[model samples]
Target chain A: EPEVTQTPSHQVTQMGQEVILRCVPISNHLYFYWYRQILGQKVEFLVSFYNNEISEKSEIFDDQFSVERPDGSNFTLKIRSTKLEDSAMYFCASSSDSVTEAFFGQGTRLTVV
Target chain B: GIQVEQSPPDLILQEGANSTLRCNFSDSVNNLQWFHQNPWGQLINLFYIPSGTKQNGRLSATTVATERYSLLYISSSQTTDSGVYFCAVHTGGGNKLTFGTGTQLKVEL
Candidate 1:
């Protein structure tokens, strides 16, 4: 099975620093999504991208957050200024289409100090 | 906004027992998925049944789109099956998923 791959399984950064989470979605998949899970909380959707543009985003994806395909293979999420509340497990998921099963990566544990 | 609710927030069972997890949606949806979050926090896709029934080994799932609910059945549960089960739904007209808190299952030997 082709799985989504994430870089830096765990990330630790200063509170005011910037952090970029990288994901390489399944080669053939077209849609991409970013979700986050706070410890002991439900998974929350951050943003969804298709055709190189954001299809939708949650309130959590505010001015500080941005996502880009960058190229044909990489999907990246960057947080301009990190905060203590930003610490969470960020997950990357991809699907061939909306109706199909979305595959997820192991996740990047983002920790802000 | 669509609401996803999962029942029996926590459950404990013996290794050889059977368990059923339920998920209910507030409105009609176009996509539904079941996932297992292991101890290592790896999210594993278990099923994507928007409607009808499907089975894979000791696991089976059924979704009734019209009724807006889904069920995940784990038979002959094992210690390895202990994890958090999540149900997420994609409401019609939106690509984002709304997830329930999830059911935490513990299978003991």
Candidate 2:
């Protein structure tokens, strides 16, 4: 089965540094999303992308975060000046449409020191 | 915004035992999905029961959209089934999924 693939299974960055997490969604998927889960916390939605633009974002998705579909197959999330609280598992997901079931990637573990 | 509540935050079952997990949502949803986060933290998709019943192998799920609740049944559980089960729902027309608190199940041999 086709799946969403994320790069760098784990990453460790210093505070105030920048990090980019990349994902390649399923080829035929039309909607892409970025979500994060703090240790022992709920999975939180960060942003959703469609048509090469951000369709919606949550309050947690502030100025420090940005997402881009740099190419037809690559979707990326960039966090500028990482904070200690930013340490979490970031998941990338995609779906055929906005309302369909989305498939998730294995997730990228981001650790900020 | 919608609220999702999962019952019995934790459960312990012996191998070959049966279990039922429940999820309750605060509002109507356009999509309802059940996912299992394994010990290694991989979110595995189990079922996408929005308003009906679907069974796969030893697992089955039923969602009553009007009632705003869904149930996941695991029959003859195995140690491999040990994981945290989460029910996620998308309300309104948004693409974001709001996840429930999760039910942690540990099936021991």
Candidate 3:
């Protein structure tokens, strides 16, 4: 079965540095999303992208965060300056449409120090 | 926004036992899904039963949209089934899912 794929399974970055997490959603998927889970916490939604624009975003997705679909296949989340609290597992998911089952990638573990 | 609650926050079972997990939502939903987060922290898609019933091998799920709840049944549980099971729902016709507090299940030999 086709699955969502994320790059840089794990990343370590300085507190003031930038990081971009990349994902390649299923080829035919039309909606994409980004979610994060802090250690021992529930998964939290960050943002949703469709038609090269953001559909919705949470408070956690503030000024520092931005998502881009630079190409037809790549979806990326960039954080301008990492904070210690930013350490978490970031997941990328995609669905065929707005109301279908979304498939998740293995996730990229972001560690800020 | 919607609230999702999962029952029996934690469960322990011996191999070959049977178990059931339940999820309740506060409002009508457009999508309901069950996911398993393994020890390695990978979210595995188990079921996508927005309504009605779906069965895959020893696992089955039923969602009653009107009642606003869903149930997941695991028969002949194995050690491999040990993981945190989560129920998530999307309400008001959007793609963002609100996740319920998970039920952590541990199956021992």
Off by over 4 Å in 3: none
Model 2 ranges off by over 4 Å: none
- The digit string of per-residue lDDT tens for model 1 on B30-66 reads 8899999999888999998889999999999999989
iRMSD, per candidate, in listed order: 1.0, 0.6, 0.7
Q: Cα deviation in Å at residue A44, candidate 1? A: 0.5
Error of 2 at B80 (Å): 0.6
Clashing pairs in 3: none
Counted clashes in each candidate structure = 0, 0, 0
In terms of lDDT, model 3 sits at 0.95
For candidate 1, give the docking quality class from DockQ.
high
Worst 10 residues of 2 chain A by lDDT: A36-45
Q: CA lDDT, every prediction?
A: 0.94, 0.95, 0.95
**Which DockQ values do the candidates obtain, in the order shown?**
0.83, 0.86, 0.87
- Residue A75, candidate 1: alpha-carbon lDDT: 98
